[model samples]
Target: MAAAARLAVAGHRVAVYERSRTHGGGVGRLAREGFAFDTGPGLLHLPAVHRDLFVKTGKRPLEQCVEMTQVDPAVRHVFADGTDVALPNASRAGVVAALDAAAGPGAGERWSDLVNRGREVWDATRRPLLEEPLREDGVERLRRDPYPGAARRGLFRRAAPRTLEAVAARELKDPRLVALLESHALAYGLDPRVAPASATVLPYMEQTFGSWYVRGGLRALAYALYERCLERRVEFFFGAEAVGVVEKDGRAAGLRLADGDTAGADLVVAGVSPGRLAALAPGATGPSAVPVPPGRVSVLLALSGARPEGTVHRTVVHGDRLAELDAVFGTGAPGTGSYRPTVTVLRPDDPTTRPDDAHEAVTLTATVAPHGRVDWADDGVAAEFAERMVRAAAAAVPGLPERVLWREVRTPAHTEAETGAEGGGVPAPVLAGAGGAYLRPANTTRMPGLYLVGGFSHPGGGLAHAGMSGALVAGLVVEGADFRGSQ
Candidate 1:
């Protein structure tokens, strides 16, 4: 939708061909039994990406299209040891105080310092890495660690932390703090043990800009973008899956759809997984396929009660991390293993989600190995995981077991059928460490006139990152290779 709107605004005749009947692929809405739930992303951060797109492409801003509400006390963390802390949104002082009160004396100070350093990292990478087209240099500049850690001097050596885990262990000095840091990475399908120290920027970005929610649900944001495209006269064809890019003289000349119809085009922007893109545009090479990480296991509940006043919108009920991390980040193959899981419970304060004030809608999400690893396609496996997740989420919603009217289980298999992500994987946002281990496919392809957008492209996944990818792709298409980025 971002690319279509931008191109249309640029006075280029634009038409979007989507395989699915709906616009938003993963960012979809589910309405069943009088309950409405956002089937994809539960939280939205870095909304400015879409805000800028709206400001540039149309007279109306994003807020005019979809109402957004800031989520205060952004997240409630329920630790394994039974300690709970609700961290306030965009409040450094509050977060520090909360950490000190929950973890120990000076724990908040350590977190404050980490955020300060994260600010530096964000400042350094925000433009070149995100707002701009990926440098042709393959971002070798980021290969060198940029995390600010305590430096040690020796007779002939200097040492500093390089990974998120190392930074947590060295600086935070609290198991809860370490778990907190690791959870940030884990939530995104990234392993803190391998994620760069700069990954700390995740928390800083959320806290600094603040987490937000569309008044209805995240699906509302997707609908807003789609509506913006329609306003810009971007034509869209549903169920017209492109079989391949029509090539003429080594450039993308048009698209060949599955129905034996051809749509000639000046350019082609593919918002698809790397594997699908390769199949659609043969001979184009992307970054070597990274094993698809685990996808989300969500349990949607319709409870016969009202949302408690002043309840935190989101909660993280930490599980046995020691037993879970290995299973989550280990091999992607199926196996029998004892698994402990971290569960996130979401209760949005919106009447639109439920039948009435007397009823409430709740969602529970957990990161587990992708479908291939545990056969999420199997009803038995999915049901068992859903039950486990619901039990854990009971910590977030008191008497949750008793309050349930009915429940719905959404597994990775559902994601696969909807979005064509291999193994129903949920892509993670691009990180700045591990020697480009997290870099995604560049917008420009060897196949001239063909560009990549969406989660599979440069700047990586997440709603905000995918929107940024569109901005980068649009800039490259409109302004040419010399285009640095959106100013």
Candidate 2:
């Protein structure tokens, strides 16, 4: 991690303790029996964050480590009735063009306006929500009830409730575009109703920054980070599952293992669950340790060969309208209404989400049955789910199943047990509501000389963020750098 590596670079002795037997934690992959499968996260979008973290440590030139480009028409949205739309990565002008291409006159103009609105919302919230850490007393003092804080305080309140459905309705004037944008609700686990208006920023970010990928595999990014940690001589104790935290006089000392072994640290960084950490010490509760929300589950297909015709690095939304998409993504579980499947391809050679002319392997993901309570006692359930998803996917690009060499399904159980992902997040958080600053715990715990790092902490989630967070924590502890205030 960047934090550990940074500390070591400053000539401090550091050791990274991991519960899993491997070094790369959630962002990792291994080649086995002739198949190079990415075990965790597989895509990238914002590269600037990683660039900044890497600059702090003299690992390699950012360009030398990873290549990047823009993915035009970043995503393709297909309706159940065969209607198609593309999410272009360009500006308002581009969305207008795509809307014109798929819909018609007036539609383009509406889409342009809608994108402009989304841009406003994105600008207002990106930093406050995604970048800065929230102080508990900060939100308690808010004037509004459980809504956004920074915007109201920063003269950006006009767009405070900037949600996808609301903004799209104001812009496109057609229910279809609204549906297209709202279709993303599954990502937040909210029906357009419960989801916050601010989340429109997720799609807006994609349209603005586009998606990114690392050459060979995104998992390589994690491995590269791990190697960087090693080159700096950071000590590592793999296979040591941290079961408890050692807090003395209100300060963290180290951690107690499930096996009763203890590892001492000056700073403790837990990339694991916040709630889990709370349980480690008396009254050390955090959002992550709380009960799991009504989370959605996801399934990814790692094809040994080429994917079917219509997949892209980002989702190629294939469905009819809003209701149909709901049925697709939500239905696998009862009363869930529907599920939405966003088909994405990881083209390593093309750093952007663009398709590689010679893409050797492919990955696909879809919402499926939640893991914890589901009876997957029958492995056939995964296969059956895969078959249904493939059938639905073929509606867009036929002949996909023939290309399948081998496949694996990571249910919620798989997510928690296999990836140290906490909840249903193989790639994202389980509770979208869990976010809005407090969503992530701080890297520094209430332990003296103990620090925490990884996706679950400040800056939060994704392969790059975890690596950067690790380094950030390392810097704070080893060099006493001020990574706490703001990057």
The alpha-carbon RMSD values of the candidates against the true structure, listed in the order shown, are 1.9, 5.2
Error of 1 at 127 (Å): 1.3
Q: How do the residues 89-118 of candidate 1 rate in per-residue lDDT, one tens digit apiece?
A: 999999999999998889999888888888
Which portions of model 1 show Cα errors greater than 4 Å? Answer: 151-158, 331-336
TM-score of 1: 0.97
The Cα local distance difference test for each model comes to 0.86, 0.55
How many clashes show up in model 1? Answer: 0
Model 2 TM-score, 2 decimals: 0.80
lDDT of 2 by residue, 1-487 (tens): 6667677777778777787788776565655334454655566777776776667666585666665555555667775446677666656677777778888778877655455555665565444344544346433322122323223345565544434455556544666676666755544344454355555555666667766656656666766667777777878888888888777667777889978888775556666655555666644433344334323333443343444444454544454444434443343344323343444333333322223333334445554334553444357765565565566665444465675655665555666675454444433321123234225555555455555666556555555456556555655665453344336
* Model 2 weakest lDDT span, ten residues long: 141-150
Write down the TM-score of every candidate.
0.97, 0.80
